[model samples]
Target: MTFPEKVDYVIVGAGIHGLSTAWHFAVKLKARGKCDGSKIVVIDKDSIAAGASGIACGVVRNNYYQPAMRELMTLCVDVWESDAKNLHYHNVGYMQISPKCMEEDVAEIFAQQ
Candidate 1:
């Protein structure tokens, strides 16, 4: 088989995790002016997002019951909101209903961190 002449990143699996990682790598490479000549090859036994991501309910929640978890979720929210402009992400709004326990847990986590 003919292979690419050069590659900057070789990603295996095209599920949500792999694709997301590749997206970030592309962003970083572009920001550093390395994307022009860089090659990012993602290989998977199946098509992109065809595994768990395809079957996933597409539900995003902050129910991890940890402050750090909530903080991380918040970071995800920020990125998702702004990703449309910077990364060409086209998606609807994010929605999450926090239970009282999760809220308390997140509060404590934030306080501790």
Candidate 2:
């Protein structure tokens, strides 16, 4: 296949993060009446979620020490909850084991969560 000589966007990978970035970026561009999403190209080595995202233990966690990261994870959980049934989500709860040095950080994360 012939690749575009020039495009508005050329995103790498097609995993969750990559796809989400492309979607949000294209939306912003169109919102400003800059150009159509046709200029956007997403090239993956295998396929969508064909990387690590495709084969995980399915253990989704939002436990984060940083507030910003926690918020982002919360948004992810929200998306998962939005389509719980079809997604077959299970709120099995969360647990973590860290060294004593990280005890304080873990406590902060728990409180925020």
Candidate 3:
């Protein structure tokens, strides 16, 4: 396909991050009645899912040590849950076994949420 000479947004890769960004951008544009294919462009030297993101095993979890990270991961989990059926995501949940020393820290983090 021939790409447009001018694009409002140029995404460099077709990995998970780039694809997610493009999808969200398209959704936003559609909501504003401005979703035209020419507005955003995604270019990758290789085919989609041919990079690091694809090679790594896909594991979704929310057991983060930092509060901010936990919050961000929660948001990501929500997004995945929102489209579970279409995305083929299984909400099997996650578990983390902390050592005796870290148990208190883990509990504190959970309490903050």
Greater-lDDT candidate between 1 and 3: 3
**Scored by CA lDDT, what does every candidate get?**
0.72, 0.87, 0.83
User: Residue 58 of candidate 1: its Cα lDDT?
Assistant: 52
TM-score of 1: 0.61
Q: Kindly give the stretch of ten consecutive residues in candidate 1 with the minimal lDDT sum.
A: 88-97
Q: Write one digit per residue (lDDT tens) for candidate 2, span 15-57.
A: 9789988899889889999877878989999999999889888
Worst 10 residues of 2 by lDDT: 57-66
Q: Flag the better candidate by TM-score, 2 or 3.
A: 2
lDDT of 1 by residue, 24-47 (tens): 888888889888424888888878
For residues 1-113, what per-residue lDDT tens digits would candidate 3 score against the true structure?
89788888899999989998998888888888997545888899988988998897677766677888888988888988899999888978657687899998878877776
Clashes of each: 0, 0, 0
Residue 17 of model 2: what lDDT? 80
Off by over 4 Å in 3: 98-101
What local lDDT does model 2 show for residue 74? Answer: 87
Best by TM-score: 2
For residue 79, give model 1's deviation from the true position in Å.
3.9
